[model samples]
Target: MKKITLWLAALCGGAIMLSGCNMLDKANGIILYGDEEKVLSSLKEEHKGQVEKDSLSVKLMDTDGKRLMIMDETSAQYLLEKELLQEVKDGRDTEALSSIPKLAEGEAFLFAKKEDSDIGFDSLPDQVNYEGNVIIGDGRAYADMFLVVADEDFTAFEAEAKTMGIIQYNKDPDGIGGFDVEREQLVKIEE
Candidate 1:
């Protein structure tokens, strides 16, 4: 009876430790976005065709010249999370950072959407500069998303703002004197 009890306690302890390790691995796993090969191929094709290099977006347009997909690194990160690519990582039982895709700083890419009419280019902000890491929750039925914007060009910033929606500059107003208006007026406006 004593031996059996000790074995049972040891089994439970081991199970708890293994579960904790698995949870940590899931949290730190590498995330990959869209088809890396396709993006690379499109860039090569564009270069070969002598396409103007100044175009900011490498949009994948439909037959009617409507933007259908975007293949930028940011968008790729979004898609990879959306597609739940983490399954591959989990299946392989690997948590090395090397598993993630390494997107170039200014690489050209393409994306394809299920519906051609869904794609739209968002307008850029007039004066805006921000740098941070954002973790997008799992709202959709797929994996959670995360974006790290270490640096940005106007185009990338605009794309992020559009996709994530404008992050409120101020969560709380500075009270009545927040703006140039009077306190009473601000209160009235709030009302």
Candidate 2:
């Protein structure tokens, strides 16, 4: 009887562990690293000509309707000057988080304009939320801030943004474009 009970307890513990792992994966968007290529490709095909050349600043929101990342043209130019970013590269891979130049308070890594039809905001899942703001300046630009939830629940948040037509495709000089979730996750709190 003791042996049976110990085995049963072990099995239950294993099941719980597995369940927790699954939940963590879902929350973190932690797919296989190689899957990033596929996700990036899908975005490229979906968002073409959505980036604005005239815009000077860009922002990325977190899953909790909070600002998380920002980019401005001045920083982009600085990156180009330092050869951290190519003067001209495919936009899809150009705006990666890793490639962004060092940022200070109120600085951004990229810049673009929000499309007309794509205007609007949606709430993220209770687990994750994000919102972004961009500031266009004469010779430079910056992202103000991003709201973030720091939890996992991004599934429902993604769905709601999709329904509201907030998702966007980023474009650059090389004409490469990709689906980016910057604005879609933001719920238009007012009008």
Candidate 3:
């Protein structure tokens, strides 16, 4: 009886430890938005010619001639967290938004969204300098949508997230999305 009880206790403790560790490690494979993988799969099947596979995002030039990237939610979430971490490390408090630097001429990226129409774009203070388009294109529509903008605006976005207080950036010690070190080298983002 005593041996059985000890084994049972050890099992329960192991289970608890796994549960805690799994949140960070397993998060990379999850879709934060609704059913994103299914949507991407369907989109790929529907428009085989339009899709170009990239490591981080699916890219194409839409029928309207605007560039598009069908990014996954996790990638965006990681970038968003990366931006916020930089902001906090810079020693800027929540009130530092008004002083956000203007984005360079050619800096933008796309993010996953599911809305039928565009969300916050021009309405976001001019400092953010962001512009977005719906993932629904002329011939093909993406169910798991995206937001497009210059790569420059990521910092403004971090400040906005900080002010909102909705997202908590957790450090991923294992590195993002499980990419090998050779595939993922860190580079400094120049101000």
The candidate that wins on TM-score is 1
Clashes of each: 1, 33, 7
Give candidate 1 regions above 4 Å deviation: 17-71, 75-96, 99-191
Error of 2 at 24 (Å): 48
Query: Would you give me the overall lDDT of model 3?
Result: 0.30
TM-score of each: 0.24, 0.18, 0.21
Candidate 2 local lDDT, 1-191, one digit each (tens): 99999999999889878543333211101111112344343333432333311121223454443333322335344323323222212321222122333434332222223212221335422222111122211111112232222222222223212111212223112322223322212110100
> How much is the lDDT of residue 51 in candidate 2?
30
Give candidate 1's whole-model lDDT.
0.28
RMSD to the native, candidate 3?
17.4
User: Between candidates 1 and 2, which one is better according to TM-score?
Assistant: 1
Question: Residue-wise lDDT of candidate 1 within 79-170, one digit each (tens)?
Answer: 34333222223222322121234444443222221212223334322322221111221111111222222224324543312121101111
- What lDDT would candidate 2 get against the real structure? 0.28
Clashing pairs in 3: 107-150, 107-151, 107-152, 108-149, 108-150, 108-151, 109-149
Residue 49 CA displacement from its true place in model 2, Å:
7.0
The candidate maximizing lDDT is 3
Ranking by lDDT: 3, 2, 1
